[model samples]
Target chain A: MSFEPRIVGFLCNWCSYTGADLAGTARMKYAPNVMTVRVMCSGRVDPAFVLDSFRAGADGVLVCGCHFGDCHYVEGNHKCMRRIAITKRILKGMGIQPERLRLEWVSASEGARFQEVVDSFTEEIRALGPMRLKEWAFIPEQVEAAAAAHGE
Target chain B: MDKVKVTIDGQQIEVDDGSYVLEAAKSLGIEIPTLCYYPYMAPYAACRICCVEAHGVGGWSKIVTACNYPVWDGLEIYTDTPRVINARRTNLEMLMANCAPVPVLHRLAQQLGITEPRWKTDTNYTCILCGLCVRICDEVVGAHALAFINRGAKRDVSTPFQLDSESCILCGACAKNCPTGYIKMEEIENRYIVHKEMNLSPNAAITLPFRQAVPNVPQIVRENCIHYKTGGCMVCAKVCPKDCIDYGDRPKFEEVEVGAVVVATGFDSFDPSPMKQYGYGKYPNVISSEEFEVMNNAAGPTGGKIVMENGEEPRAIAILHCIGSRDHDYHKYCSRVCCMYSLKFSHLVKEKTSAEVYQLYIDMRAFGKGYEEFYERILDEGVNVIRGKGAEVVPSGYRQHEEGHLIVRCEDTLIGKYREIPVDMVILSTALEARQDAKEFGRKLNISTGADGWFIEAHPKLAPVSTTTEGIFLAGACQGAKDIPDSVAQGGAAAAQAMKLMAQGEVMMDAAYAVIDEAFCSGCKMCNDMCPYTAITFDDAKKVSVVNSALCKGCGTCVAACPAGAIMARNFTDEQIYAQIEGMLS
Candidate 1:
């Protein structure tokens, strides 16, 4: 495959996850480049998880959550909101495009809004090609081996 | 039948030989004042108010009641004679003495120039003992609910023991036929007598649902029909020239097989009674949009008059919008069609009546073609467009009140001031809500509904009419609140979509589901928590995550979260997505 800008999306189960599903349910067509990963809540997404996706050759990372209030797990989405801000700063220090990381709010009912957010985010990521963090990144094999051993 | 000649007021008239003198006089255009002589029943001349001079054929003359006395050949009947006038006067004076000066008795007394009664009873009563109510109960209705109880002065019309008779059907036939207006019907406990425009029309006992109802037939409201209750009044069947009225017809359920089903069950207008502030059911002239629409209809109970409950033209009319919609406590979703229809109501009210129209709405969503222009037109016509929700409706409680009998309280958001508009009528443009049994109907069709109970479509933009079910479709307000044009377009689209399903005859769904490579799995069980549907389970013996394909929604969340690269989404794998991403960047 030619050089590609792979993007990863971590969507929360209650709000953003259903919101993207609502986009499909609402039939709001948009760019289909971003790969989605669903979690129980936005709090479950770690900053290391965003780093890991980039290490696995993703050019960008998008974290989605419920609107900024007491969310799925009381303050789960709020915690995610604060985490993404720090993650963006860290990406810039690591010689990556800071704009590659984005945090968006998509309620369960805002299907058209989700489509607009996704389309705009995809365009921004496409402008900055492959992350190339993989040039000096930690290997997936090493991380998998460590995780499997820890389970045992 | 042999005809006989008679002289009434020295004018010769002919009639059927055994016909009553009242009929002959009526044929001669002479009106004889009579009571207790209902033509439908045998004339019970309890009140001999139609007395006349009848010179018999044998040269002997006597005074007789014209209502029951028969005319004979050479019979000289004089209705205007002094003797006839005196006799009628005497009979009415006696009735006037017995009963209270009711309007019916007073009108008859005025016709005879009787200033006052010669005698008076010690105790005055309402009933003249005309026996019309009792006769109708016994002879016509056959309900026998009302009977002459006691004797002489103490006699009155009453049901047996007067304690909510089990046999009393509450049919109001006696009340309708009672001429004195003394026999009024009382409301039974649980059964509601529907008002003028609320259910059907005021005359819903027998009416066509509308002038253009398909099958073009009149239906008898069995609940209101007297014949259905007492099995006595076949009046409609008797009077109908075509004799089409059938008391035997009953509703029957029929079933049919179809390739596809279209659910366009429509919507019910939101009832504003639940919001106690509106005072819809608690006050007069506060009407729902549906009731107002019916009232505007030419064939409606008021005959298309935009009048107040007191049967007078309204001075000012207020149209309140969004009764149960777009409110945090009631329904959070916009009803979507209220703003446009409220504008239309203002236009109609302006057209039909000289009443000043006021439109109170939070937001005017005139989002359709010419809808904005229509709003502009109403504004030009001097409709007061207050940008706010109507808060409450109450009686105006003013002194000089031929107009402005009710007051509408609201905050004008545009001007940022509290406003209370006094109006004679308030029309609530209530929201359109999903039918009460929409969920049950959705379940029967294997479809789902959104949180707001609108049927969830497969995709709104692409398949707006198709439901989540394979061959089921949705149209009109059942999907969401929509105006007439939108609903019509959706109805046509739904028909076409259902047609396409029937033509295909079978379904074709995507088979893209996540699968695990047995050699690659490291058995960490990390992917089990990733499935939102709980479709993945770990096989204890194999020590690997197993995905039930039937339950998988193919969202690919588990595939991306898999640590050991064991799980990959089928058809649209990570590698395939990377290829598309490459093309997008290029």
Candidate 2:
């Protein structure tokens, strides 16, 4: 089968999720490869969720939240940023391609930006092909080792 | 109140008569895992994690949720028996099976020794049917926005009909109490987050005042407002408790008659973006002092935390003084407030943050009362007061940390050497200048502006507040750069002058008002129309225009507009102008 990147997006309900809704209402066509999972706030998204997405056969993961200072929960996006930064660092050390995980800020009014980000990120992920975890058989040792290293 | 005997985990404890088993267990130091139960809220038995085996007086034994089951006389409760553990484990397994990805559920399962879930994994939902949010929103907040929708496995908590409800206050109480973090309030409060990278400030379209001033009014800035820009997003109007918001409100104009006017229009902060060497607009951390003041304000973006753009507390800060002020290439005059405010920044930075502050200045102009004492106090606080003008702020080459530091390049005049001080933040104490519309405003008020564009005072010292125009006065920084004390003094002086003018029943008129020659006057009505003050009126019977001396200020517009050459200003007649020109030529 031709390679189609499976991109999982964890979108904060206030900004990015609403932005996606705006994109739909505007009938802005973007890549259909990306599927979104809505969360209350970006801060609610644990780093484990991003890891779980990759483990569950997602080729790419996108965590989008409200812009800085624009978080619905005052500083939720700020917390999201700090956690994502740490998660990216952990992903890099785990030998997983850190580029697969993308964190962006999309406000509620940025419908065009949502379409653009989705299109660009989908194209970038398509170029990278399927994630290594998806192709490899369930190797308990390697997965456990990677998880242990990330836990540190 | 009466006490009741209750046995929790086989330990007999006396509790309030109406207390639940969970509270009685707590009185006897028995631990019960609770997810949906909160002390401030009514007991919600949605999460059955606190299930316990209860024994009745009639020798009946059964499993009951400790959160809602009431304590009674001679009631026995078992919290950690094999049957109770099995019951709790079954409940946790069902929760884990249904909400597999929720970290809180997984944590609770692990704590209860339910390492592996027996049922099939379902990742479709994260909420464990915890009704804390629903209960709190309905009971405490009084906003019945959320409710349990659907039934059984397909059940979910949502706004009625899954539509954006009008009753939602966007108070975020539901989101705050949600154990699974599902109900985001972003839909209700559609505030666009502006300037994300810079961490500058947070603002809504229609916002309340920053400080406690009289009337503490909220105003709408149309440009950034969503309703004004896109004709959408009336969330502010919807959420307002008093329903006081009116999107239909328009700008209004009214005319008022006054004997005197006090021009207290203040100055504007100089924009330093044009000074590329400062790296103000380019650098994320290099901010103006006004922005710093907001950042330091308790009600500001970071809630008064002195953090850099990237959320790191600055280890060192450099306060640059005399930016765009006291420079011949820009403003020629010293912005009198910069030096003191720069010192204040130094004191605040040192007090708030652990940052080592460097005060860069051309000279310390602490000339006001107790100002020198404040300067000495700041000096005692270990602030590095350097005598030098900051040349430029550039990124430091030291990449010791992930975030690069900024280096302030300046000549240390005291040491006669150039020094590059690395700091995380640089606050530019920019100069205050006349508002861009000062000239137009001066012209509209018929007041003379100085060569520097400030409103000219009648006299430099004796009549500082009075303008060249008889009935108008100038106050505060509009006339010159002044600190709070001087501005307040000038305001008082201007108010007193206005009150003095109002107190006088009659005012002396200048002897230079326009006069109409009835013999040569024609009733063309051109002069009457041309008079700005409406001082000239046409006489229909005499066919001549008459001048109202009391209303005229001798502008002589009617003299130029008169087609018959019949109007003449008393002091500015043609013969007097010719004499003045002749005298000037001689």
Candidate 3:
């Protein structure tokens, strides 16, 4: 059977979410590995969400928001960028491949982008193979403590 | 603890895993030409300047944006290759022809060894539509003023259809960052016959709050606007210099779907008015740190003259520390700036007017480079350093009715004595407060604010300049109270963050965007027009509108605007949001 990765995508309500809708309306063919979570701003995607997805069996986590300076809420995407940077580092500290997590800035106009990103990130995650429960073994208590420290 | 090995420019380098190409390149001292990349902002790939060639199995060799590209194990990347170089050069040439000035283009042309324009146009504007300035101004500055006005061949950078934009804060950012010289800011003042002082309150025209500001131009405060007030008063237009105050303009609601988001909203200063004990409103002499910055500035009120209300140079100046900060009554956060700025004020006052300077503080925090030494030098100059918290600033009652000379009451905690020191001037170091309308603004953008009112960053320590909003950046005194060094550093950092994103010619977005349940969709086309990033389209053939994921920014305006409730935002579908809401209720 072909490997179907479970990808969790975080879409900002303003642009990315609508772009997906456009893709669907246009019947754009793409991968079905993605399960999207809508956020008001890409900035709202807590690192907890990304890590939580991994904890909940998501093979890849994708975060989408407005183009830079294109946020409906002003600088929310900027905040998301900074957060994702630190999150990637934290994810690396764990046994998780940072490449499994992606942060991108796309506008509502690029439905093809929506299709492409999902296809690409899904492929990347698939290439990385599955997150090993033992390889990523962490004392849940320890991860919780770290998450608390990072204020995730 | 282990470093991952990646090859760039045929050189093997060991960098920590999860490192981006730009970060890895920087570690190896590889200088990549970038325009719209900032570390604080996520990789946007808008400019297509940082394109590099990568060769490997399953490695698509077409140019990929290096800024956003993640470094992988056993990945062979070429930072400089003929195909990649040509693409970059062509992209830059198109940009140059569109926006760069003769000198910058000429120099670049000389370096690239191109003598003439391949696609020559006879236009005077020299700004390449790199979108760096637009992204920086909107995302970093949080002003949403300058943008790419018009599209394609008619695409010119202007404020809402080439009108005098009251929206622009005149931050001079567009001028400061234009790679090409097409967008030169010429300050032209329009004269108006004066008459409305008595009818106006102090806050009436506060929209132009930055008028008489240091970088003197009109900075229209959007929240305090009459349009925002009662949605009335287009007064800014009636009395604008260069007639550059357009109220008829609104932000373009386009959307773009992406795979990831980078939150880089910066910080803002704390306002100290909650402690009415400082008498900020009642005492004309007491001013916040920013106001004092403007006051002491050569271009500030009183024209940089260190004079009291009586129009006399202060014989003795009292500098109060931590008006709204470090006190339990106000913000518990130490405004890392008060001490150094207080000393700076003391020096400026002493140098300009030779006044006796007294610095009253809870504790002298000179933690920066040359700061302790600066404290010692100020002491050597005989500036009185009192270790105590100031109690209050009252009137001396010696001068004219409103011009009563000021007196500072303080408790010298060390000496255990209360000293009502007589002084000609009292400088209140006010706290940097969050914007009053932060919550509403956050709601509009689908982001949240911290309890302290400042836009909360994703990670306080690791991500200092980012907020909870994606594709946006915070800079200057908007995220939190910071010193000059930190603000400037953050500003440049925010710019770099944006550069990284825009540097990618095109961004890949997540598929978690809205998927219209076509049967439910009413074909209203509201989402198509309401999108701020222009990410939606109507398929006449399909008889239903479609959203372009690359263009959709995911603002739920269309979802809310949908009368049929057909347009549902993804990831936050009506079902999921309702489930969460229902769970909360339970």
Top candidate by lDDT? 2
Predicted complexes: DockQ each: 0.06, 0.00, 0.04
Per-residue accuracy of model 2 over B1-586 as CA lDDT, tens digit each: 8998988766788888888999888867788998888765669798999999999998999999999998889999988889998998899888777785577777877877876788878576678878887886677656677889999888888889998777665556567567877666574457443212211112445555456655777777565454554354465676678988888888899899899999999998999999999999999999999999989999777899999999999999999999999898789899999999999988888888888999999999999999999999999999998999999999986656624889999999999999998999999999999888887777677564544567767656678898656779988999988899999999999999999999996798878778999988867887776555677887888988899899886655466446677877686664554343233222
Where does the lowest 10-residue lDDT sum fall in candidate 2 chain B?
A: B193-202
True contacts kept of each: 0.00, 0.00, 0.09
Order of candidates by TM-score, top first?
1, 2, 3
Give candidate 2's chain B TM-score: 0.68
lDDT of 2 by residue, A1-152 (tens): 78888888878766788779879988999999888876656765567667767776778888898776555444557767887888899988866788999999997668899999999999999898888784454557777777788895
Clashing pairs in 2: none
Error of 1 at B88 (Å): 3.9
Off by over 4 Å in 1: A1-152, B1-32, B50-90, B93-97, B109-123, B149-170, B182-218, B225-229, B256-262, B273-287, B294-320, B349-362, B386-427, B467-473, B494-586
lDDT of 2 at A112: 92
lDDT per residue as tens, model 1, A38-134: 7656755667677667766677888888775524344556667776888888988887788988888886667787788888888888777666654
Which ten residues in a row are the worst by lDDT in model 3 chain A?
A130-139
Instruction: Report the C-alpha lDDT of model 1 over B1-586, residue by residue, as the tens digit.
Output: 9998999988898789888998888888999887677666777877788899999766898999888898888999888878888888888889888788888888998988899789876565778888888887777777877888888768788888767776666666676667677777677786554222223553557877776789877788887777877788676787788989889989889899888898998887787888999888988789998998888888877898888888998889899988899988878888988888888888888888888999998888989889889889989999999998899888876657534488889999989999999888899888888888876776667565566777767666877888645578988999888888989999998899888877887756447678998789888888787675688999899988899987765656566557677787777566665554344334
TM-score for each of the candidates: 0.59, 0.56, 0.40
